[model samples]
Target: MEELDVNVSSSEAFGIAEKIVLLSFISAVILMAILGNLLVMVAVCRDRQLRKIKTNYFIVSLAFADLLVSVLVMPFGAMELVQDNWIYGEMFCLVRTSLDVLLTTASILHLCCISLDRYYAICCQPLVYRNKMTPLRIALMLGGCWIIPTFISFLPIMQGWNSIGIIDLIQQRQFNKASNSTYCIFMVNKPYAITCSVVAFYIPFLLMVLAYHRIYVTARAHARQIRLLQRAGNPAEPRQGHQEPRQDHQEPRQGHQEPRQGHQEPRQHPPDQHSTHRMKTETKAAKTLCIIMGCFCLCWAPFFVTNIVDPFINYTVPGKLWTAFLWLGYINSGLNPFLYAFLNKAFRRAFLIILCCGDERYRRPSILGQTVPCSTTTINGSTHVLSFFFCQRRGGGPAAPGLAGQRNQRGCAKVPGGVGEGNALFPQSPG
Candidate 1:
């Protein structure tokens, strides 16, 4: 008997320790999601350079959705886990579950919006993008992101649309005295589950994939064009008079090259350096956005896939496994902050300033001629500067009527080729 009693005590102690560790882990995740996303919002709002960036509006909205998930959804999910049952009333349970769906859907949709914004900026008409994506239009888009999810999630959940007609097994289980009435579970309505999954995950995912693919292809084509231009331009011969610009955008075939037969040479065409610079920007942005999208897929896909499958299987998925998937979705909110810090230079600079209270790099020069040494590296052959409005304007390009209005803007300059103009084929940096 004493031996049995000792084993029982040890088991209880182990269970308690395990619970503590679980609680601590969840708490850490929630804390990270809150702090990291909050920092993003603060940095964008506070920094002069970041504030001027129009695309960051979508980023701020995304961070807000993630922050809401951390505050409204994760803590309640943690509560249910720790207590081993939902202690809150059914009304609050419905509210909490609705928030879970709404915030995460908002996060995914905001990503879609960001992808679209980039697509227009990098691939569409610059004037159209600037005109259409103004502050009011962006506000409306953000409003729709939240409103659509609210209608799909909270209202339907309250109206019992997520619940199927009475199930004999679930009904019987509910009446049993030993069954936990406080535990919350979806009622496995096939139509509702499928519809929600399609709207929330599948459609937006396809759009993002298409946008990024086009962005990638466009960047590649620009790089190839620049290389051909560089190889074809010859400086050895001088022309007698200025040559007319070629109208054909197509390049000469490698095997079909011909030498100048006359005693004159091709006119010395100035370097379209801004075209190369814009291509690099487009490529970098595409890469960074792709990484973010990849992370989103890895984090949320499992949970959503399982959620859809559970209904088809009559919700036979084990409670532990279901909860695990839910937590996996929540993990995304925490991961985004770290991803931003790593991939985005501006975010890293902002985070360092926020966390360390100040950055020496941003500090002013001391008196008496003392100055802080700042080292810079040229990445990918360009002198890298942090431009919030990247690859949207250029200097040295042929001045166009379309770019005349933009010329007054800071960092707008004429570059070789029609760089600052509204040409879809070439974009220019704001540097």
Candidate 2:
């Protein structure tokens, strides 16, 4: 009897130690999710340069959604995990489940919106992008990201629509000796599972895939064009060197010399620098976003696939498996802040500044310091000021007759005749 007691007590102690480890890990993830997302929001809000880039607006929205997930969803989830029972009652269970779906779906939708924004910025014409991604349009997109998930999350889950055909099974499980009323049971019929998963995950995933694919293609084409231009420009360099002495004689004809100088200037420097910079920016942005998208997929795809599959299989999926996948998805909220800080220089800089208590030494020069020149052009009867580093002009004056206006008020420049479409990929500095 004493031996039995000692063995049982040892097992219990081991179990308690295991539980402590698990709870500690969960708490760390929750804390990281909260602090990391808060930093993302605060960095954007406090940094003037980050605010100027419209793409960061989408990022801010994503962080906000993650922040809510950390605050409203994660703590309760951790509690349920540690307790191994739903102590919060049925109504709160519904609320918690609804919030989890809502915030996560909102986060996925925000990513889709961001991919769309980048697609328009990189793949479409500047005029089209400017028209399509206007402030009002952006605001509408953000609103849709938050609002669209309610149909799948709150409305369905709270109304018992998810458990429609499974009501009997749910009731049976609740009354069974092995289960109890304290368990927060959430089950879905096949139809509800499919509908909810499609709305919340699959559709947005498809859109993001398409958008990123097109962006990849466009960026590759731009890169190829840049390479060809570089090769062609290389041969002209030696020719210019040989012609330097001959320019002494041509100086007498100032008119001819001035035109040649203007033409040669762009061929020598502007196109190469501009195209290279634009290509680098596009590549960097694409890489960063793709990493984010990939992480999101890695984190959520299994849970969603299981979410759709478990219903068809009669919910034979183990409860432990369900918990594992759900918390895996939750970990994504924490992962995003680290992803941003590690992959994006701007975010990293801001993070360092924030962490260091806003030390001036952590500050870097703003992209605004690299301003080129701005020219105004009228497209479809509306005058728009375009900013560019160096205007590639065919002649002495502006590329278009309407480009006679002064520099843009925002201190940004544009290519005179839509020649700097690449520059339009980022209205401000690239994030």
Candidate 3:
């Protein structure tokens, strides 16, 4: 393909009103991405419920990556937008561009890791997920998420492999030499562009879509099995029958007090019924996360698609149109925190308290033991107390006897025995 010459021109000076609107828009996006993601980090760190769930590690990591993009990448992009020229010299330009690639790619990679986590959580055996996704393992994955993108961005751009070959290298060198160059853009040839598109966007996008589809399929199959079990008659009654003895045996083996064992361990949920209930919960969560991944794809697809095509088209795309798509990509960072707030009850309440500087609704427990101001949200008419990554039932289905006495300030009631009488099902909190 012949190199298409683009006539670059300085943007016309904006009127005061236009300038104000542009600055306000940029500021809003920057603030939302920064503050929203920051709150997510805070919630994960501070909230006992969120901290207990291992899956939330992925959420925290994702939020951190988005925070970096908001702080490091978006501000520089904003500066370029306002100035209409690369006032910052070459070293800073390289740094900004590298950080942009590093953080955005890290964000996408974190989403991929989350999808993998959800896939295993939903599709595999509970024990399998428990054994596989340890904290050390997750930390390793997070490390790679940052490391791989940094290598790709810095090595190629700095070493000039992204431009490739003699002619393209000469073009990049001459463009750098031009002290009057107005725009900050990374020039790349077909190989580097195509390779990066595959690694950063296309491959991750496909994997995420496929993972979500599999999760949906598995969830539907589980739902169907539950329906069949329900039709076959009350599977729960006998399952509950068996459940009592198991808890009875486990409690005594673990040295629960004799009096407490009888009071706590005997209470049982219909095992099949609770299993079905849990399946529904997992399915609902999978759907919500899939929707988030879909939104991310929608926001970023245009830019990555154009990113690859631009090189092949000899960079023919208009600068303004390219800028629009780039900003559209940035919109995903701003959208993620809001998505968490909208979908999850805990996040919404946390956001409200954090943003409002404390609301009266979140009152501390009184001496006589008042309501701890649990973060409850109305979902399909029923109230959901979103404590962690899982949808905790308001009353965790027939509370054990010891629970009433053991209720904590955050509304986490400790039930005796290994049985999770009033707790989230997977990875029951230690007594």
Per-candidate total of colliding backbone pairs: 11, 6, 0
Q: How many backbone clashes does candidate 2 have?
A: 6
Q: Which window of ten consecutive residues has the lowest lDDT sum in model 1?
A: 372-381
Worst ten in a row by lDDT for model 2: 400-409
- TM-score on alpha carbons, each prediction: 0.70, 0.75, 0.69
- lDDT tens string, model 2, 1-431? 33422321221232567779878998899899989889989988898777876677888898999999999998887776566556776788899889998999998888788778767766666667779988899999999999999998999898888887778777554332333324556788889889888988899899988987876676566566556545544445667789878877776786666886665554446445645765675566557657767898999999999999987776777666777789899899889777644455667778899999989887877657754433434332122223332332323444321221222223333432222232332333342
**Comparing 1 and 3 by TM-score, which wins?**
1
| Maximum-TM-score candidate | 2
Model 3 scores worst on lDDT over the 10 consecutive residues at 415-424
Q: Which candidate leads the pack in lDDT?
A: 2
Q: For each candidate in turn, give its C-alpha RMSD to the true structure in angstroms.
A: 11.1, 7.8, 11.4
- Against the correct fold, how does model 2 do in TM-score? 0.75
Q: 194-220, model 3: which lDDT tens digit per residue? A: 888888888888888887777667655
| Residue pairs with clashing backbones, model 3 | none
